[model samples]
Target: MDSTEVVVRSVRTVGPDTVALILESPPEFDARPGQFLQVAGEVDGEEIARHYTLSSPGADETFEMTVGIDPDGDLSPWLGEREQGDTLEVAGPFGRSYYEDEPRVVVLAGGPGVGPAVGIAERAMADGGEAVVVYRDDEPAHEDRLRGLEAAGATVLVTDEPLADSDDALDVLSEATGQVFVYGFADFLDDANDALAATGHDPDDAKVENFG
Candidate 1:
């Protein structure tokens, strides 16, 4: 756990169900894409831990995480209540970074899943690889941030494609040559795999990251 204590610099609402948790990074913090922070705090007399995807691109000094509101959730509520100048504990950069310099990869994300996708795309962009991203039902506040993500050279697609009755996300995802990286609802992975396998897409190429 390459952990540190971060001071809460600001908190901004990104959508009805999401908020951007901005923190002042510790000195000499260097985190790669796909890594996460396990924030530990007390909520309602329980030892609570929530893993948040960092949104601060590159090795920036300001660490930020995109959090979705869970009405029945224990941690996000407390996290949402945090004001500027507060402090939070985080430990991480504790996983594999998104593939760098890989062939054309399809980034499939839903809601908060976009952060890691963008991080991966950023890494690919840095390595000069072709990357495409697809988002489903993005947070309203994040629309502006996401719409221009692809305009900076990467291809980004946003769709209302149903993960159930429609295979649109699947079709768009398969258009990429090499790989598909997906993150979001558990059922999304199942539906994606089912669609891919049914359509004869190579299941080996796409990697699924399910966080349940």
Candidate 2:
């Protein structure tokens, strides 16, 4: 991972507990959709690092990362307090589950997992490919971006219901003829795989990024 000092350009609330941090990208910095960065900052006389996925389809000179703050967490609360011009150490354009120019793509995201899923869909659409997102969240994160994706002709299914409990959650998988990407916590990944299997879509065919 290459480390660089990046200045915060802006911060805005995307959800009740989530904030989008727009950081000034180094001239040489570049990352694909679905990749994450390790952000470290000094807090309480100690340095804490946390991984946050890049929340944009692509970037030229700036990028965004949406972070869901855990009130009880050490790093998130500290990060949430960051302001414009604050500097932080950043490393990585890491992670393997990136978007490919497939004929069609299906994104299954749970909760904050929507961050990367939205990016993937955006990139896919930019390449003239089809994308469908089945997003499950009680109180959604990145709602505006999701709506933007919808406006861009990507199909989006939003529901407060859990993906595992919804009978048709995985039905999109059956119709998909290209790649499938699943993003969520471990348990959600497991359930997503099971749902894929139940729908006759090979669970192994799906690229998974587990938050746990």
Candidate 3:
């Protein structure tokens, strides 16, 4: 992976236990929606690396990553404490699943998985394609951005319950014909896959990105 030094421009809270890190865009640093960066910084005199999905579309001159801080984790706590002007090493625009010029897309996300799912929806809308984002969270993160996506011709569904329980799940899948993206923890992914199967769509056909 190619490494670049980037200076943190700002760090702001996006939701409870979540933050958006705005960093100076490195030269030629272009990443697709759903791709991640291997970010490294020194913590307690030891270098630690963590992968964070790029939450911003590639159109921006700055790089934005929305991170969910884990209080018990070594890297996340340090990342949450990062301030403006701090320098961190970043590498790769890695990941296979991303937005394309498909006619229709279904993005299913849970919890912090909203980061890349929203990014894909934004890019899809910008490309004049239809995007349906079905997000499951009690306290939805990136509510503002999701609303913006709705205003931009993307369908946004927020459910406080499981995706299978959502009344619109099967209807949404029926309309989705192109690519399907699913992001969440392992169990959430499994549930989503089961939901997809129940809707008569092949679960294996969807691109999945799993988290902890």
Candidate 4:
């Protein structure tokens, strides 16, 4: 939608390649899970705006995003350079937040894809939903955050590499009776969506987000 100025509030590392950013937005604006805001900054006289999904759950004027830093990645490095109090123009806490007050949920996150899924899970658990987080490469990707989920009463299922064929993942995913959310890179989109399909879940009951 529209853009607003936000100030950098903090930064923390979430994974080997992922950085979690905390931003202070206008008190009148509240951001939701799965929504991303475009943060724009000037790099060497050129302006760059990067869309980052909120990683931590918050309200009352704070927001977060877990961004993968590629050494050569333009938008990422620019975002990494921002510091506390630095102002950024952010627009549209955009994207349809894959969230509901449902009572049960299965969150499938692959790679740095845990960003949005973790955000979704946090909210679900707080609302008393039975939740599970299935992450690839486990602690290496989640570290203390996964522990936070466990503490919040979520069952975490982890798998390393060769991330089971789509079918195999589905076999494991079919156990959840409520909604399913699959979060991954762009390449995993269709396969994961199909996996949910094979489980007999309604396409509308499944939510998929691609971090390209």
Candidate 5:
């Protein structure tokens, strides 16, 4: 899609230094879980833009992007300060690594990657599918939603330890069956690949979105 303005529907903190920025969906916007939008805003007399993945399960009327506040960064902190009715320029529901109604899914996430993990898992469950999330973050965000997913029968594991060092995470990877997905920074992706290899899962088979 071309660059257009979107209105902020709401903003609230989801976890420590993290905020869920809900925006009114643009007309004809057909973004799926794990896809991303390029959001732009003015900060310090210059326009700054960044790509944020869809954190909401679907883009019907409204959508959400999970922003990790960085006090010293260029854009995220500004995004966190947006209030209801604020407008921001956005474009494209970019990226190919997204959920597509698979019967079963396994998501391996790290840090802000938890956004898409939860989004994809929720969408899968809503479609009568199964989901398993192995997320690694020192301070997990979207805690309430994660717990809700667990209560709804999805297997969720949130840990602070590295995937290569966590026995339980490796065990789950070894036994779980599904269309695997991975989302994180480069280092985390490397660790996830190593963990997948250790568990006899083909790393190349996992649909990965690297947040480099």
Candidate 6:
């Protein structure tokens, strides 16, 4: 979709220093899990924009983005403070690493990357597919959603240890069967790819979206 003005439907705290921003979907706006929207707003007489991936499984009347609050950042902190009825500019459902009805999916996520991980996993299960999520975060976000996914039969493994150092996480990866996906910043991506390789998985085959 082109740049369009949308109203905030809600702002919810999903975990420590993290929020789920729900916005009214623009007319005809279609996006899948893992696709991203460039969100923008005016602050201090200047416009700032940031890209956030879909945290909601689908874009219906409203879509959601998970924002990691950063007081020092120009856009994230402002995004965290958004209230219902507030307006922001959103553009494009960008990126190529999106869910495509894959029958089996294994998502490796770190920090705020849990947004897309949970989104894809939910969609997969809803489509009668299988999902496994290996999330690494000290203070994990979307804990409630993670639990719900687990309850629904998806294999969810949450850990504070790096993927390269976590034996359980590696074991899961070694035994997992599915299309692989990876999301996070550069450092996390490095660690995740190393773990994938260590587990006899092909890193080049994984669909990845780097937050950086």
lDDT of each: 0.71, 0.84, 0.84, 0.73, 0.94, 0.95
Rank by lDDT, highest first: 6, 5, 2, 3, 4, 1
Please give, for residues 1-212, the per-residue lDDT of candidate 2 as tens digits: 58889999999999889998898888778688888899998998999888888888886888888888999987888889999999889999888887756768888888778888888898999999999898888889888988988999988888777666776675655665668899888877887787777777788888888887
What is the lDDT, from 0 to 100, of the residue 69 in candidate 1? 81
lDDT of 3 by residue, 1-212 (tens): 59989999999998889998988888877788888889998889999998888887663578788888889987988989999999889998888877766667889998888998888888888787889898888878888899999888887888877777666876776666668899888878987887788777888888888886
Residue pairs of candidate 1 with colliding backbone atoms = none
Candidate 5 runs further than 4 Å off: none
Task: Indicate whether candidate 1 or candidate 4 has the larger lDDT.
Answer: 4
Give the least accurate 10-residue stretch of model 4, judged by summed lDDT.
161-170
| Model 1 TM-score (2 dp) | 0.84
Residue 66 error for model 1, in Å?
A: 0.8
Regions of model 6 farther than 4 Å from truth: none
Check candidate 3 and list the clashing pairs: none
Per-residue C-alpha lDDT of model 5 across residues 1-212, encoded as one tens digit per residue: 99999999999999999999999989999999999999999998999999989999999999999999989989999998999999999999999999999999999999999999999999999999999999999999999999999999999999999998999899888888999999999999999999999998899999999999
Task: In angstroms, give how far residue 73 of model 6 lies from its true place.
Answer: 0.5
The TM-score obtained by model 4 is 0.87
RMSD of 4: 2.4
